[model samples]
Target: MSDEDLRLSADRVLARLVGDPTDSARLREDQWRAIEALVAERRRALVVQRTGWGKSAVYFVATALLRERGSGPTVIVSPLLALMRNQVDAAARAGIRARTINSANTEEWDTIQAEVAAGEVDVLLVSPERLNNPDFRDQVLPQLAAATGLLVVDEAHCISDWGHDFRPDYRRLRTMLADLPQGVPVLATTATANARVTADVAEQLGTGEGTGRALVLRGPLDRESLRLGVLPLPDAAHRLAWLADHLDELPGSGIIYTLTVAAAEEVTAFLRQRGHTVASYTGKTENADRQQAEEDLLANRVKALVATSALGMGFDKPDLGFVVHLGSPSSPIAYYQQVGRAGRGVEHAEVLLLPGREDEAIWRYFASLAFPPEEQVRRTLDVLAASDRPVSLPALEPQVELRRSRLEIMLKVLDVDGAVRRVRGGWTATGQPWAYDAERYAWVARQRETEQQAMREYATTADCRMEFLRRQLDDEKAAPCGRCDNCAGVRFTTEVSAASLDAARGELGRPGVEVEPRRMWPTGLPAVGVDLKGRIPADEQAAPGRALGRLSDIGWGNRLRPLLAPQSPDAPVPDDVAGAVVTVLADWAKGPGGWASGAPDAPDRPVGVVTIASRTRPQLIGSLGERIATVGRLPLLGSVAYHDGEIDTRVPRTNSAQRLRALHGALTVPPPLAAALAEAGGPVLLVDDLADTGWTLAVASRLLRRSGAAGVFPLVLAVQG
Candidate 1:
């Protein structure tokens, strides 16, 4: 087709996409350039444009033109389920038959693949993780790569380690690209990519050695419709109160972003209590609930959805009038991607950031989960190499010190590098020479630190907030956005009503979270030198326990974080913390399923208090146990002693099997405690400062039960999420 004909065809498709069938809608020059590059020249291209800048239109229009020319289906590697759903619906409007095969719709995979093979589907979208699936990678991906006319990589920055949301699975795209039939066009698009990330992605998108460089079309990153601002509050309570007071006054229905899942739920509950319609959306949200919440926000049926980064990409509500962040993201690039969700279709939308003091702590915790050390990586490779058959993740987990999630990630990277291969049962060693890239990992870590420092500057800087973010992305056109808080002299007020403030305080201050007991033992314990397996006998299980609050909770978490820091000196429980602990006990005693409940099934009241001897916080846990026993008028049974203080501090945050192995036989019941339990004649209270893995509580409870206590009730100061 001639250039003019291709442009005309693309313009007609754009009209259909926007519901203007009269051909009044037309593609922008850059959009036409990309479509022409793919169709006319069969060239790979990378388009780095801001959000809502018609990146989707370029691919859909290109798909229409290519299919009309008898090309095979356009295969899109989408990141999120939400994004896939939106693109599928959008494709239908342009008369393109689009189907997705993702985790959400596994039952439809065979049908979708069949349709694509039949050339009945115009576009087929699959997640990045799907490319690494053993069956899909070995069976379906090769055939798809052969027949595919155009491959679209949405959110392409994810392929680069420097990208803020990088995933190891995305690197699998390299193999697919290398195997693609010659002259098959590819397009990679992203809304957030600095210069380094852009260069990295473009280089990777190039189909190996002989395929010349990809055409790069970079554009400005300015969103004219957004008005950015930052409103600093005294604390979490004040921040919540300010949101409760000002949410409704925002232009229209929008999102309230939180840095953590606990914060999302907390904000949602507080907003609902304040008579505002809201829902919580996080990675933990059920798929059906997330779908419903997305629909509700789109239809303006609810005021807002308090969400984490799970709702960041591919949600296309162009008229969303506001974007509010309860806590700042760790990277300015990530903050830009999230806030870009707002003001896409509207001319005026409010973007506010209420920075919290806890953001850096949360950042540090996440940073610790980065790629493991070279020693751990080598150990994992050695284990796989020694195995005769493919090792399932659960079976491999007991041998590797890495957590299951981290282990899976490491395996995916190895698979992409040819060091390992994911097979029918699980993963197998390829005996491929793989060098640990310590220097590269260290460079990425340093880059992350730089991003963190930039985010700090973003929150505290008095300059234009949008401009600061744009510059972080290496945008050359990042002139001062004249409509920001610093530029426009602060469009919002920090004053919150006294009533709202008090209500927020009450909601945050009221504490007492249920600690669900560990039911079944970790699998493959025998492999870890522990003699446990299958269901934990119900008789040996600890009863459901209570904690004053969660370390991730916005309310009590803010207070407990500093008190429990690794550097915190061991001391007696402070007066305020002790008082809160008392309040939790008061509530738990009268609540349902409590021993003091007058119900028929309630257990007998705890007869004594048994504390777990803590190597780090003995003063805190000991004093807490003494105070509880004195308050309840129960005898203080001797503490559960660790034999030779053989505690493995490294096991606290590790996988279940490793933790259980470390704790087996390490804790013992003292003879005095056994005698006291024999005399008490009723249930006893187990006091500990914290319950991170719940392993200690479970082991201690079993010992108490075997030693003659009728029941064990665990009382802890905090629970870690």
Candidate 2:
């Protein structure tokens, strides 16, 4: 690792670039100087170049220099598939013997590996996720290690937790390169990196103190060809409407970003409905669909694309004339990356954001979901630690016992938190378990919060939007671009007041109405009879006399019976009896399982009953109760409850049985629903009567919690005791 040994005197590396006849692109003087310095210094170097500054050219130049001097093959590790593809394509266009390894070419990866090993491949582009493969590391990497070559890491900022787009897998690359010879140099390049990120990249690459060099090339972040605009939209719908109105004005190649898949679908649907051809991309999208959509956009078959942040990184659609964020992003880095997609071909472009009052709230939710609470971190770590080998999503789901949706969100959160690392096929723990600092987590959380706040300010402030962005990038002395929303003739207006924004509200609750018993009357009887006959509306049956008579005749306690009961004229129930009913309801609300709820002898048996309150034969409730009983039979069963009618059937019906039947028809279990619930880290039982309205017993346990059900084992059945 001496200075003399580190120097890139290898002329063959330089020849690899300049020797290629197709490499017509020339490096700028500053880029050349940086390249010369890296070659002479022979140490790990950080090259921070501006967008379109041809940072790739410097690497190519150095590669040419090394090739001329008979250096070994060069390997470039990239985080983006599209970026890797683009780099490989560029090298091929330059007549360099370059090959790439990514998810798209599994069958060819082994051949590519052999080629690299035999020294037939000069440059190799791969993703960090691919490095975890035992075959790649054990068989393929050793060959690359033996060759006299350089390792180039692209988008190196991903190594830093503080970096806008942090990737935990990037941290493992240091160990991956540990076996390389001491004299071999490593070069890292990025378009954007603050001092903190720079230091992090160097440290993660194991470029020890004074052994690494950083070059921060100054360039204008300002793009005069790009017109910045901000619109104050009340919601996503309005933003879509605005886009529709301006669709004709927008260029054919452009991108529209939404915060979520639902939003992306909605906007894409709205645009297509209005006669604009659009493609969409999101995590839920199938691989084929994603590729088709991307291809459609790239081929100009689709005039525009509505996507989430998934569209960034590797996408190289340089002809894009505009980039519009349906809402504000969680960070300035995200905003810059998204906006950078535009004007890449040196043509005029436009970037717009429809800022709303809830933008900050929306961004905060995304951030929080991305960086979950400490408990979640512990859970993820535990799950990873328990695994004997790397496991895919399907294999891990049952072990963690969480719903797929919930687990996926938590995984993404853990990824952003840097507590866990996801490789190509599986995940593993990263750093020390205690390495997750609360202060750093809080800072990132606050930074996300601040970016959202800044969006609000940008939308409402009289100053230029471009200037605000520049200041965010640490160019505080930069002047206004004089071409943004504020620079134009637009006037600032505050539609929402500070008080309204600051007002605290309850967290999002479950999405349905709760069903409570009509009267407060406790039944001393051990058995209750259920009537499956007529529609019993909550308001119509809220009478004390009717409820008491039914309770008195049903013999309510432990046994269940089904029978039709006519309305009876009875006196009002006593206050003491009513108070007893309240106590029972409270107990039901508290549910049957918890640390305070004493352990039962028969742990696998149902602990409580759920009676569905309906006038007709409580078939829906009966069927649901049976399912709950089955769930209670689970080894770890804690509680059980059933609803009498199809609580989920949103339709109103006068005939109870028909309504119940209809409800059953509507309650089909979603495929991913069971997986998601299992991942929630609990065992649950769902109950209902007749399984009618079909919704009550089908993933009802999970839905209840989602809808803000305060207690577990809440039941719905068609009987009264």
RMSD for all candidates, in order, please.
1.1, 16.9
lDDT of 2 at 597: 50
Candidate 1, residue 711: the lDDT equals 86
Model 1 C-alpha lDDT per residue in residues 1-721, reported as the tens digit of each score: 6778778888999999989957899889999999999998999999999999999999999999999898999999999988998999999999999999899999999999899888899999999989989899989999999999899999999999999999988999999899998889999999999999999999998866556899999999999999999898999999999998999899999999999998999999999999999999999999999999999999999999899999999899999999999998999999999999999999999999999988888888889888899998898889889989999998888777777888898898888889999998999999979999999999999999999999889888989888899999999999998999988888899999999999999999998999889888877778768888888787788899999988878889989989999999999999899888888888888889887778899889999999999878989999999899888888999899889766556664556666667778989998988999999888898999889878889999999999998888899999987
lDDT of 2 by residue, 598-656 (tens): 55621232233333333343443354444434434433222222243243423423222
**Cα-based TM-score, every candidate:** 0.99, 0.63
Candidate 1, residue 474: how far the Cα is off, in Å: 0.3
Error of 2 at 257 (Å): 1.1
Off by over 4 Å in 2: 1-25, 146-148, 206-210, 370-436, 488-721
Which 10 consecutive residues of model 1 have the lowest summed lDDT? 645-654
